[model samples]
Target: MQRIISFLCISIFLISCNKEKTDGFLINGNLDNVKNNSLVQLFRAEGRQTVIIDSTRINEKTFTLKGKIENPDMYFLTIEGIKGSLPLIVENETIDLTVYTDSIFASNIKGGKENNYFNDYQEFIKKIRTRSNHLTEEFKLAQQKQDTSKISSLRKEYEVMMEENDANDLNFMTKNNDAVLSGLILERALSTNKLEFTKIKEIYANFDEVVKNTRAGKVIAEYITANANTAIGSVAPNFSGPNPEGKTIALNDIKGKITIIDFWAAWCGPCRKENPNVVKVYEKYHSKGLEIIGVSLDGTPQQKDAKQAWKDAIEKDKLTWHHVSNLQYFNDPIAKQFNINSIPATYLIDAEGKIIAKNLRGAALENKIAELLN
Candidate 1:
């Protein structure tokens, strides 16, 4: 009898393991305020579009969706005629969903480890937003009372909260390196510019093969390739665009001993403000074998004349550097190639065209130029 009991225990353990590692997904879903027989669709995001994974009809305000996914990927569940869709991390496990049809974004999605991580992250974000709203109200009160010290204190507190939040996100992403959510998290980290590019790349490389093949992962891979164009120690990609006179000018044509690629726009206020510092740096370093090629992102749909505005800003600011523009705003091919998101950006390269630094400004700009040339 004792031997039989031992055999039974092992059998039970193996059965449980098999159940846990089921082969396909099953979504047991119910809706609030949704009529019976309503249609529900499950969509999977491909490269640039979403393809339907499965669909089911609600019976008595309940529906079930079943499918097989090779990986845990982002899927959206939509109820017919609903204004919003419920986003879920679909894994090969039984998912329990409660659709708040009135506000679909508030829907509850509980499933595998991936969904749990995402839900926990959403809760954290909600708390941060609540604190931010409270801080905004406090700042208004402090302003109305003209309490300078209180205002300063609140500002510092806000900054601290943001820093802590960013750190928390980084920690989560690093801890869940194998999670599909890490792909999205790394993208956010880059867009916020909160972490160094090298650190971001390291974290991205830590992701497992499955996560790296997801849509989000593919997008980040593309961004990494584009951003590498200006990454330090990498040879800068040479580009040519129409100058202010409509004549084409190439980077190789005006390559100097120390070259500065300046990405800015006439409409950018910060660029306008920093023009003088750039002029000072250029005036000091031009005779010292430093050359600057100003790439202007001047075109905007609202602007009356893109080329005229570009020329005026250069002349008014007295920017004597060789300037070029496609007048295509941030859509400029060169800007797209460099993945430049903000203006007043700079890339400092050596005589061999290898990028040495990026986004330097003011004293940093002048000092780097001096160190290289002087």
Candidate 2:
């Protein structure tokens, strides 16, 4: 009877696992000049190309793509034909990608204000490309002339152009914040600028107020809220936790030196892999007023004896930095306050106790420190 019960349990678990799998879609389209040779690429909304489910040739006017996305979100469907290239978003089980043959779908899309946002977004893209090209030319000229003054002046001019571009983008979102482009721009703005948190919150609120009915609106609201709720520039929230040494430490006590606050865990493979790079940077810069404070997110004492994994890793990796943890895993107050949705998260706070950078890792972290310290 016990053997039969175990078999039944296993069967139920397998059935549940199979039910979790989601089906992808096929894009059926008709284009005038697209000679059955067009290529279609499926890119997840927030993933890399290497992880693409599929990129295949269109056998005919109709192309059938097959895969299961773990989540149902936006995916870019691009058609690369001999003559030209066209791209569109596929957001459902049945997506129609019909485009005119004579000229590639200049901007074929669907929906209401969201569609209008895409139209304006094409224009915005052109403007950004042009401005970026101009900046590139100016940089080239400055380099060719080996003129430091010209380089500085041109850089300043480029910065002004970028700022103007940001203002234009904000204005665009005021009316068309329901589109994915606006949300993307908003994310970029917040990610890049140190002084724009207030404006970022205002833009987020404006989107929330204006576009309340669309899918893009819902996603934008969620993203903006999450980003605003836990950001590096905001005061680093406090935590009281014991380190591997069994001594309790509070975040507020580490106030005078520049701190690189890192949140990681033993179970996270990426976090372990990234530690060596971090260790190198720490060794190189620790003496010149650089300090590291690690907050482990490992869970309670484990059955597999992984509870001491953090300590073992520190000893093996020769990590001499200050480390502490509440052993509550991600439920720790610091992780919640910092919005640490992912592991290996890092923040660079200046001696003034204000966070200056976040997610700076590997070469980028080293370059930033060299620029600031040297």
TM-score of each: 0.66, 0.50
Give each model's whole-structure lDDT: 0.78, 0.62
lDDT of 1 by residue, 152-240 (tens): 99989888877777777688888888777777667656666778878878888888887888766876787788887667899999999
Q: Candidate 2: lDDT over CA atoms? A: 0.62
Best by TM-score: 1
Model 1: ten consecutive residues of lowest lDDT: 9-18
Q: Report how far residue 312 has shifted in candidate 1, in Å.
A: 4.1
lDDT of 2 by residue, 1-374 (tens): 13222212211100001112235544455554566767776665331123465677766566666664432334444578544344443333444455665655342443333444555555655565566677778788889989899899877876676666556767877766555455555644443453355776677776654344344455445545655644667655556678898998876776435778889888778988999999999898888878888998887445154458878877887888888887677666677667566788998877766677898889999898777766
Candidate 2: segments with Cα more than 4 A from true spot:
1-39, 45-57, 61-74, 78-89, 92-112, 209-374
Q: For candidate 1, list the clashing residue pairs, or say none.
A: none
